[model samples]
Target chain A: MLEVRNLSVSYRHTWAVERVSFVLQPGQVAGLLGSNGAGKSSLIKAILGLIPCASGAIYWKNKPVTKQLNKVAYVSQRSQIDWDYPVTVEKVAMMGRISSTGWFRSHSKHSHLLVRQALERVGMWQYRASQIRELSGGQQQRVFLARAIAQDAELFLFDEPFNNVDSQTESIIFDIFAELKAQQKALLVISHDLSETLENYDKLLLLNKKLIAAGSIETVLTNENINKAYNRYLPVGNSDQRGFPSLPLLTNQKTPELQKSTRC
Target chain B: MLTWLTEPLEFEFMRQAIAIGLSLGILSAVVGSYLILQQMGMMSGVISHAVLPGISIAFFLEINVAIGAFIAGILSALLVVNIQKRSRIKVDAAMALTLTSFLALGVILITSLNTDRINLDEILFGDILGVTSSDVWRTVIITAIILILTKLFYKELEFYTFDPLGAKACGLPVNLLYFGLICAITLTIVASMQTVGVLLVMSLLVGPAIAAYLLVKELDRMMLVGSIIGAVSSIAGMYGSYYFDLPSGAAIVMIIFGFFLLAFLFSPTQGILTAPELKNKVFYWLRSLLN
Candidate 1:
């Protein structure tokens, strides 16, 4: 449902993300793996049309991305949001409908139902009236997930939604993603939790200033590939090594346990 | 108390003074809530001072003072917003730059206008006792219009003030909402200048709202309490000025200052000096050590 061609983004004199390219089909989740300041955020920002792109083109569902903006939904990193803001959970979730609802008229009843369903999906309906500041870190992350659900778009871009959330919340959020995939939606998730990302996503885009590798988890997540892209030492059986499941490196290991059980 | 109130109502000047004061108070309190929420108290102060030049220019041109002040306030607000967006200058420094330069221009304009017959005291220190019936009606009508408009766009305004980025992501025109807020603030300041002058107008614009902020958490309740405080303080100051022969503007400002101080010391949740735990072990230890 999405394709990118020769995308390059830079800030002033520094080249952040360079010469990146990939394609994502419907019902697929593409995981992005990179270190700090490795240009992941910049690429996402460029995709969102926030930053001026130096060079690149993006296609969403057979149309140019810039022309099909309303069809794209993004859940940005939670750190950019101010927790002390006076907005409520309901209002945040309803925000996703604004682009689609147009400017003058009030949101339609259908949009309201969608928002309610989105909240239900993330188990945040009880907190609808609650001020966003009054929620725990995990609940707050769930609120953003609900917002993305409310967008009801064909593609989803989640930027580090798992940061600061607990394991149970993360697992619950991944369940929501499974439902989205069932509906034939494409997802690009930027996560630091490489183990969860590798086990869930169908494809992995290993990036560090460039497109180090882009393919199935096994082919792209090898120890050699990660070492080449990151230039960092990784001890065998290290948690860091386990972080982005390089499938080819673990050929003898069974397929992802959760995905395997669920598929069977 | 009824007889005392009826006696004051009988005098024509006293009646007009009360009417004008009440109108200006309501306008200030309503607009001030949004300003305080957006942390734009300094911006309001800057705009209020900056309007002096526009008024002075209007005086020289022999045009209406309100129009000039409105134009000045809007123009300065635009300049400040633009500078903050385009340049690397911080908000505080940008506001200071805009306010000082415009105020300096106003000083120069006032000096230039001094060649003609002009009583600076009348404008600088308002004469509430001399407010004509036409002026009183003007204040009331303007206040009513502003209140209606505020009510109409209340939700959008609240959303914009609380979360600009979220609003933008939702495809709301964040820039337009911000500019609209500045315009509302400008109109409020212009209406208030008739009763409180530029230097003391802040007490009306920011004082009651801040006092209400200290006391309440909800936006709607804060606005209601702010308006009440504004109205009550206006009446008290007007009466005090009549009895003690004080400057009406200064008296009203002092009263609002007193309210702010009292609220600061006694508010339930956020009060500093009069908190619930002031008598607890923490305070006792600090006091004992100091002694």
Candidate 2:
């Protein structure tokens, strides 16, 4: 299990995340929802100790997260990577074993087997020799997924794994997420997706520099919570009767489905 | 052709120059591969110039100049990192500020302290033929140490350079790895200061590595190929310098650029002339102009 207590992150004296608290239980897939500049990335970075938290603590398995980094796996957003880097898909997968193989020693045969198994699981084994830059966005994401799988960590954090990925890659990712959850691994995914894909997550945490709601999708997707998270007030009917009030929540630009629904 | 090469070996000064040149060639490329991959090629330029103040100070203190150069080089790199982290200034701007400040300080100390033993022209352009036997040994030792360290930490360094955040999350000591890399780069610059001088050292560091980058898809292969390119350029440049009466440092830099041009124009996978897409684009443009 992972726990964040009164987490606060500041950048240049401005609050990015203020006093946000949440818990991620094992066997749970929680989707972290927030608009742009809503501190989702900052919160994740702070938890990973990539950036210093203003004032907060993160704990994993009852120990400080900083001391338990080996038990955690994080896949940053695709845009943060330099695809032009001169690494083969196989080599990138092999990097997951660097810590386990120890310093000043070559990778063990067991490490190679694990890397091969992870690449095969992601259906990227055939392109193992190709350079990373030659792959499409979906394939690139799959390669990172393979790397995460090879890490064999107890906690997984993904930032926008679905961005720019194809539908096939999307299904592959969901399948892996289901497998990880089945194995009792804790998972937190940051995503902008507010479509029917919300059903895939076991829970949702809505945020706007602070935690607005955290629970089952139906409970967190309330009209008032959505309006508060997005800072938009629409005079639509009561959200109770609306089932899943899929208001054009974050992006401001309405989805085609939302436009059709609004017409009715 | 054999006599031309053998004749230079007969002279002790020529032998020392050749030995130092070849060692520096291999050393620069190996260390330089990381510099270019990190998109911090100019950082090499910054550190090389930053060593000037350290050299002058070391002369005043009667210590080994290489020690001073290494310390100064590392300090400048750290300052650049500090400035970028503490403020909104980007890395390039930080590097520029540090580079000029250290270089100016070095110049002021050199003139103010009357370090008559230090030759400004030799420091700027290099005097390869004047190198002693000890200079040759120092270059060789630095090369061997750097190569061994790179081999021992290959996997960790690869992971750190490719994705620093992911490496850190996986519990790799990325900060230590970065400091180790900076130290290696600084040591390489200090060693090459006599062979190519600080002003032209960036070419030795970046040229062969980038040339190999155009043709290879993996880091290890880049290092291997770049070392060969570096070695060849050094040998050819030495021969040209001995026969044509040109400056040795300028000759080597020219040859390095010559090899880079060849790779840029004819590499199988990425060349402007060899890649099918670029080749067709050129032909199409010419045909349209003719019409």
Candidate 3:
């Protein structure tokens, strides 16, 4: 179990995220949603200790979260990587074990097998020797997914993973998330894809600097809450429809399935 | 023909210079590959110039110049990082400020000291023929230390260089890794001081590494190929300097540039003139001529 209490972050001395609280349990997928500059990335960075939090206490397993970083696998945004770097997919995937492999030592056979399995899971084993720059955008995302999978962590935090990804990658990510949840691993995904895919998350966190609401999809996606999160009023769905996920945005697809009910 | 090669080694100074040059070549290529990957070429330049103030202070206090230079180089690197952390200025802008100010301060101190023993020209352009046996030993020790540490930390350094943010989030001490890299680069510069002075040191650091980068797909292989390129250029430059009485530092830099040009034009994977796109056009043109 992971518990965050009153987490606040400031960028250049101005508060970006303030008094945000949340909990993540094993075997669950939580989605972090917000508008541009709404402190989504900032909050994640604070939790990871990549940036300093102004005031917050993150406890995991009844202890400070910092003590248990070994059980955490963080997949940063694709934009943060250098594609032109001279590295193979196999080497990139093997990086997940660097800390555990210890200093002054190379990866053991066990670690190698784990990387192989991770690459195979993402269907990227054939490109193990290929340079990272040669892969497509979706393929690159899958490689990063392979790295995270190889970590075999209890908690995985991914930042904006599905941005501009192909449908195949989208399905792969969803399947992996489902598999991880089945394995009792906790996942926190930061995404802006507000289509039917939003239904995949077991829970949603709506944020606009501070927490707007936190609950099941049915409770958090109310028209009043969405309006408060995006700072613009949106049409409300049927009030009694509390059992299923709501498609909040209309995509380029012409399918009438969600064309009228979802708009961002 | 053999006498030309054997004659230079007869002189003790020539032997020391050659040993120092070759060792410095390998060190610079290995360390410079990291700099090029991190996009810190300008920072290397900044540290190289920023060592002057340290050298002046060392001379005034009668301490070893190399020790002074190492301290100054590292100090400049830390100052750049500190400035970047505390202000909105990026590393590039921070380096620019630190470099000019340090260099200006160095020139003033040297002038005020009125020391005729200090030759500014030799310090800037390098006097390779003046290399002593101790300089050769320092180069060898620095090379061994750098190579051993790089091998020991290859995985962590690779991960850190490829994706710093991801490495940090994975519980790796990324800040320490960054500082270690800075220290490595400063040590590499100090080792190379005898071969190329502060002004042209960047050429030694970047030229061979970038040439290898265009040809190789792996960091380890890149370092190996770059070291080979650097060693060859350094040796050839030594011969050219011996026979033609040319300035050794300028000769080495020019040869390094030549090798870079060759790689840029003919590298197997990414060469502008020898890639598949150009190969097909050239083959078509040859067949048309025959027809």
Q: Number of the top candidate by DockQ?
A: 3
Model 1 regions more than 4 Å off: A5-10, A62-70, A99-109, A207-211, A223-264, B113-142, B214-218, B258-291
* Model 2 residue B92 distance off true place after TM-score fit, in angstroms: 1.7
Give the per-residue lDDT of model 2 (tens digit) for B1-291: 799779989999888988888898889899999989888899999999999999999999999999999999999999999999999999999999999999999999999888857987777878788799999999999999999999999988889889988998888888899999999999999998887789999999999999999999999999989999998888788888888988878999999999999999999989888988987888999999999
lDDT, candidate 3, A1-264, per-residue tens: 878899999878788999999999999999998766778888888888888999999887788767778788898877778899999999999998887788888789999999999999999999999999989988999999999999888888988888656789889999999999999999999877566677799999998899999988878877788888877664544221332223344332222232121111
- For all candidates, the clash counts are 3, 0, 0
**Segments of candidate 2 deviating more than 4 angstroms:** A234-264, B279-291
TM-score of chain B of each: 0.90, 0.95, 0.95
Give the per-residue lDDT digits (tens) of candidate 1, residues A97-201: 777876555779999999999898888999898878879989998988887889888888887777777777888888988888999999998866445346788
Q: By DockQ, rank the candidates, best first.
A: 3, 2, 1
Q: Give all TM-scores, in the order shown.
A: 0.82, 0.93, 0.93
DockQ of each candidate relative to the true complex: 0.20, 0.74, 0.75
User: What is the lDDT, from 0 to 100, of the residue B188 in candidate 1?
Assistant: 83
Model 3 stretches with alpha carbons more than 4 Å out: A236-264, B277-291
Give me the displacement of residue B284 in model 3, in angstroms: 8.8
Which digits, one per residue and each the tens of the lDDT, describe model 2 over residues A1-264? 799999999999999999999999999999998667778888888899988999998999999999978788898988778898889999999987777788988888998899999999999999999999999999999999998888888999998888878889999999999999999999999877676677789999998999999999889987798888877764544222233334443333324332121100
* Model 2 docking category: medium
Evaluated against the true structure, the overall lDDT of model 1 is 0.78
Each model's C-alpha lDDT?
Answer: 0.78, 0.88, 0.85
True contacts preserved, each candidate? Answer: 0.06, 0.84, 0.90
